[model samples]
Target chain A: MSGFEAATAVKRIGDGRYEADLDGDFGFAEALNGGYLMAVLDRAAVDASPHEHPISTAATFLRPAKPGRAELVVDTRKAGRTAATSLVGLVQDGRPVVEALITTGTLGAAAEPVFAGPAPAVPVPPLEECTSMLPDEGAEGFAGQVDMRFDRSTMGWLDGTPSGRPEIRAWFRLRDGYGPDAVSLALTVDALPPVALNLGSKGWAPTVELTWHMRAVPAPGWLAVHGTGRLLSDGWFDEEVEVWDSTGRLVAQSRQIARVGIGVRK
Target chain B: MSGFEAATAVKRIGDGRYEADLDGDFGFAEALNGGYLMAVLDRAAVDASPHEHPISTAATFLRPAKPGRAELVVDTRKAGRTAATSLVGLVQDGRPVVEALITTGTLGAAAEPVFAGPAPAVPVPPLEECTSMLPDEGAEGFAGQVDMRFDRSTMGWLDGTPSGRPEIRAWFRLRDGYGPDAVSLALTVDALPPVALNLGSKGWAPTVELTWHMRAVPAPGWLAVHGTGRLLSDGWFDEEVEVWDSTGRLVAQSRQIARVGIGVRK
Candidate 1:
């Protein structure tokens, strides 16, 4: 199987119990990406639910999870005509590394919005004009499997030029040839380098908790992600991101709070 | 107990199982408020875990919860040094009404921040300069239990003026003598009138799902709430709200997607 397939693959171990073998391609400093973790949980959540798409998911990162054998214990809270809700736990070493309350529903792939909102401001430039966040040294881990083309105007942090506003606009898609799906949208919502990075923060600002919803099925092409931070204070910052599909549909919305990076307090 | 007390009070019926009487004071029409439902779940989730504060909660509304009685089933997903996570279900009449994943943690009320960022940009007017959202006709239901003073600039929707932007800036506090706590913050995070109202929409916009986090224990005073909507399209819209304490400390942040109000469409 390809790396993305291997990293997100989930096998039904028993009734409501699912297992996945964690591979290193999705790790960051010995820990799996939070979005990747949610994708795995999404697999199990989808497996246990009657629906086909994840409507909403709130994930709490209890601890850093390493790549290895992981188990997802799914508990269906409710199965209804409109939606199905489940509580999934990503357990490792006899402990839950992450837990989520995922609500899933079905959305028609060809569904069209009756009245679509305008595309978010700041037109995305051509891919060549976008800045590649992947290290020039060579992409590794999670970054290797995703293509993120950040709008250059928002990447002032790299030069110590902080944009007074906390925001990041980027174009993103998976590099592994896997088309955008509910799982890829999960990663896309969180895949942006911390928005705080644009506000003069440095280093990795770990997310304490994240909540996201899949509003509609994303069309094939680059997803435009616009993220903005409301408040950056007291060792914490809150970011809200919206993912618009190539077809102009708002596919997903997410909000998260993370700890500030060391020596990079706003 | 007063109405607020009665509405939020939870009784431990057994290990991991708690019950609350669904009072009418917290209701809207024939259904209970989603924020109030989360407040009750927050109480149970916090109690079931060792933590003193609920740091994050993502709740999905499956069906309307009528006023009368409800139950919360708490399942501890993990207990770590920094955070305790659980999956909680709000059940009424033997049917699940709301399902949530709540992460609880102990935040020192007196803890100091090494670095704090700027407060949100909008300058909130004093309580006297703000426009009261509570209908002047007469206070009712959930509106009577909380105070939300919206900024006039963002209240253009009230007079059929679409500022062409989706936003709501307000000052909020509970009407009861009770001060802001983790539970109160839950309500406060969602207390604002839907932001879609600023985009030429009207009437009640019911939230389908909401996720919020408590970054710190709020001080005893009104919270400055700033909400912005990224998209208002099709039959749905998304709103993101950030609550700041009287001391200008960031307290809580939340995001939710809801359908457009009846007779209201883009």
Candidate 2:
């Protein structure tokens, strides 16, 4: 695991229970990044159930996890024939730090076939065609792991131009050689807010919070991300992003809340 | 107004903002009810800006409102030449209660019109046909305001049956005489979870939190709600709901997080 390294090693403590220790690299800043925490939880969800099933997980950031080491525990609350429920907790020093609930099950055998809205008609720019637009300050930290390419539609702090539109569209992929698992897929999906904001403006903005929902897991390959930033008023803004596989399958969706201000990092 | 009588009294504070006292027959429970909040916030978005644009809004539940008095505030964060952004905050006793952000603006001159996939071809059952299938307990609070009919292919909680598959489709409409607006539309859209859960099992569950996003406002009359519940391995579940107009246009989308334990409402 290079770009998609698990910050904490997951250990099954007992039936439906597991633990892990937190690492400092997982911290996006002063605290563990929401995306990092989500990635950890995603791994635990897949481990809890080996079979392939659509999993939906949501987490509320209760407290920030400190550096050094933390523990993760998973408990199976209910397991039905079609669907099962699991609760995971990230703890440090025996105290609960973060908690999440995840659901996974095989796709139903309904007579109706799969139906999805058409993939947005936005064009996908090649990785080499677009400029590398990451946070200048945080760029060094995440560099060489996840590579980003910004098309003309990109907005936010990296570029000084603001389209002022609530929606943003962009193309993204890993540096190469990263396995396309739920955790790796999540890392790429969760890293687009900075790019979305850049698509809106010619500057950089750090995301204060993010929440993601996977409509269905992405196919094995590079990914396309389309994000829309709505309701940016009173120093706060919320964005919804839809991720599509290379073949145009709607894979995952994410929402983020960020506090906006006039500060630039060189 | 009946079910909508309380929400109708809410006074608009300013651009995309409104306020209602937490007192009277409609108290904190009604004000903080997920459906009611979604409706009010939706209306405020339209009130702040009219049909010149299409809007999308999402709310995060911070804390519950106290049953006494409260105020709702909305502000347009970004009003560019084309798209605009608005924020709505529900404040009680001078403290922030529930906060929502909305983005609405004109569809730019279309070089070409595009849509993703077609809507699912689920059948719509008559409202009268599905009423008998509602869960016996707490059926009164829900059935009184909204009439629901479900597609025969889906699964639910009513009829004392354990949830088979984890998805539901239903038609929803106000009882009668509820004029169309943001508030009424919100209430009608917010009321589908219980009915959707009816497809799960005979067990009772309460929504602890709810969030909604709308591509466009629904038509002013009867609406159809299609929802799917993903039960996590933990004792919690989340429901994703999409409300459609009679014409089949996707009107609004919503998600609710709820604790899943069997018990009677106090």
Candidate 3:
């Protein structure tokens, strides 16, 4: 199985609970990424509901997760015609690693827009000119599974230049040929690096809390990720992301508050 | 008591369950405003936790709540050293009106930032020059409780001129003598009219779902609200808000997706 499919796959072990096979493929260093954990949790939520898509998710990181066998437990609170509510938890050794409240619903792919402005004005470079951020060697981590080609315009921090704006835009998709689904859109909304990077912060930015809403089912092709941060304060920052399908529709939108990196010398 | 403090005050009847007093003072027409409901919900969530603030809240509106008696139910999932997780539900007549997952934690008011970008650049006019949105006659309802002075830049839609950009900035605070607090911050984060109004949409814009995080405690003074809508499409629009305190600190941030008015013509 491809890594994205494997990491998000859950087998129903019965009684509103499922067994999730979490591997090292979705981790950064030894800890699993928050988005990946939410994706795993969402699978169970979707399974528990009559709805087809996980519409909204709010996840709080309680403990760092390691690659292992975990339990996906879901509690159905209410099920209505338009939406369903469930509390989903990812547990290891009977301790909660990530807990989320997810609401599932069905969104049509062919819904016409009454009114929609064009995508943000930043243009991406042609495929040949886009800079690939995939790692050079190993296929064991997050960067290895997804192809991220940045626009290079907002990536000036590499050359000691702070773009004076907290924004990053890129073209993204799975390296294993998986198209966008509601579950994968959860990971894609948080797939890019922190927008604080372009504003001169450095090192690993850890997300404290993340909440996202799925607007529509994505069309087949590349997804454009636009991330921006409104505030970067003492040890904290707020980042917002918009995911647009290649067909020019918004698939998902997310906002998160995270810890600023260790040292920001710029 | 002032409208805000009285509406949000919960009587702790027992363990994990409290009684909420809903009143029409926080309403528009017969339905209670979403922000006002969230403000009351945050109050109960903060009181149940050992921490002092409601750091993150993701609320889903399941049913419309009217002015009456309701129950505030709190379910603690994890109580960590720095943070605690609880599922809060507001029920009236044994049906869920709103349910939320709130993470409560401590944030310092006097903490110094290593770095912070400036507040959003759309400056509001001085208090003397600001335009009042309060209804001239009825001194009763949500508009009467909070003082909002608009920048008037995005209000050109009132005169048949669309700014072609979705943005709104205003100065706000409770008309009552209370200063900034966690409960009040929740209301302030969602206090303004929908930002989609500037894009030529009109009438009552209802929030489908909203998620917000408290970054820091606010100092005593008028709060500046900077609002923006990224995309308006498919009869839905997404709004993001940043609330800055008088001391120039980024206190709270929120994002919500709402449907357009009853009808749209362009």
Candidate 4:
């Protein structure tokens, strides 16, 4: 199995139950990446669903998930010819950690969109002009597994020069040679550094809830991710990300509301 | 009780359980407006949570809800000091119709956003210069409950000259004078007409999944609701709406993926 496929692997424990191990490599600090958790839950939902692609998913993060053994329970709500809906919950030690309503459908690879809007408003420069996020010593933890090249203009947060706006643009791919697919797009949506980073907020900005949609079946190559936020108030912020494939087709889109970390450095 | 309050009333029956009647006045033809269903569901989540505001909600419409009776079952996932999360489901005749993960919190009326982005990009015209959706014979169905005025430019679809762009902008408010609140904002987000109408697609577009956030408490008066879509492909389209309060604050935001009605008009 490929690294991503293996990392998100699920074993059927019963008719509606699944077993999985939260990969430690996907963690940031002590908390697992929310996107990784969604990918894990997507595997369980797809295994139990008659549909092939996970088209839409609404996930609520109940608590921080740690790297360890987990159980996925898929409760099929509706199974139809065009689509299927399932409630997939990731549980650890009998407690629900993350719950998601996943809707699956099949997409034709050759079909074109009847109408497509301009790509995400934020423009990203060519890959050669972008800065690589990999450090000279190499990346570790979550960054190590996902190769990313960021638009330098939005990376002012690293040098303490926030853009006074909430936005991030990056090109993403898996280091394990896993090509972008419907399941992996779930991970790609939440893969960018929190938009709050550009708003001068510090520390870990944890995602509370996230909803993503797969617009089309992706073609293999580097995926461009553009994220922007509309509001940051009362310690909360909302981020919207759009993923475009190499063929210039919009592949996926997502929006998430997250808590702004209290730990800030002036 | 006010019209909105009565229309969305829910009675607590047991621990984490409630019952409500789906109001027919909120229906579009025979189908209930997805926003009204959300308002009904939000009432149950608020009643069950210690918090007063439904901060974030991710809902999946399993089936079209009819006017009559329905049951709401709330399963508390976490009740933290800052917020509470619950899995609320609307069931009719022992079958689940709508399921949502609602997160509740308390927002201080005086709290200002730490940093707010520019409001939704789509600009709406002044209400006085706009075209009212109320027919000459007076409003009926969902239109009777929620008053809306559309920007003259976006009303081209009505005259068979579609703008050929997926966009809609309007001013919205409740007819019964309940004013704006977190609960009512639920109804405001999905209140706009489908964006696909401007794309020249015809008939009733059914929303499959919608996720909305309560950004801040409103300041009353009419609300500017701006809706836009990024793509429509393979019979599926996504609409995003932003609700700006009379005081010019963004009170709520939402995005929904819906099926494009197969029946089209030349």
- The candidates' DockQ values read 0.37, 0.05, 0.44, 0.68
Can you write out model 2's per-residue Cα lDDT over A137-247, one digit (the tens) per residue? 345444445565666655544446655455556666655456555566556556664433543432344343344655444566767777765344323345667777776
Ranked candidates, highest DockQ first = 4, 3, 1, 2
What stretches of model 3 exceed 4 Å from their correct place?
A134-138, A152-165, A198-203, A264-266, B135-138, B156-165, B198-203
**lDDT, candidate 3, A28-146, per-residue tens:** 88778888888888888998999998878888777788887999889887787767878788889998888777888787778776556567677566656778764474654787888
- Model 2: number of backbone collisions: 46
Instruction: Please say which candidate is ahead in TM-score: 3 or 4.
Output: 4
User: What is the lDDT for B229 in model 3?
Assistant: 77
Model 3, residue A221: C-alpha shift (Å): 2.4
CA lDDT, candidate 2, residue A224:
76
What are the per-model numbers of colliding residue pairs?
0, 46, 0, 0
Chain B TM-score for the candidates in order: 0.93, 0.72, 0.94, 0.96
Task: Name the DockQ score for candidate 2.
Answer: 0.05
Report how far residue B252 has shifted in candidate 2, in Å.
Answer: 8.9
**Candidate 4 residue pairs in backbone clash:** none
Runs with alpha carbons beyond 4 Å of true place in candidate 4: A263-266, B263-266
Docking class of 1: acceptable
- Model 3 scores a C-alpha lDDT of 0.81
Instruction: List runs of model 1 lying over 4 Å from the truth.
Output: A108-125, A133-138, A152-165, A197-203, A247-249, A261-266, B108-126, B129-140, B150-165, B197-204
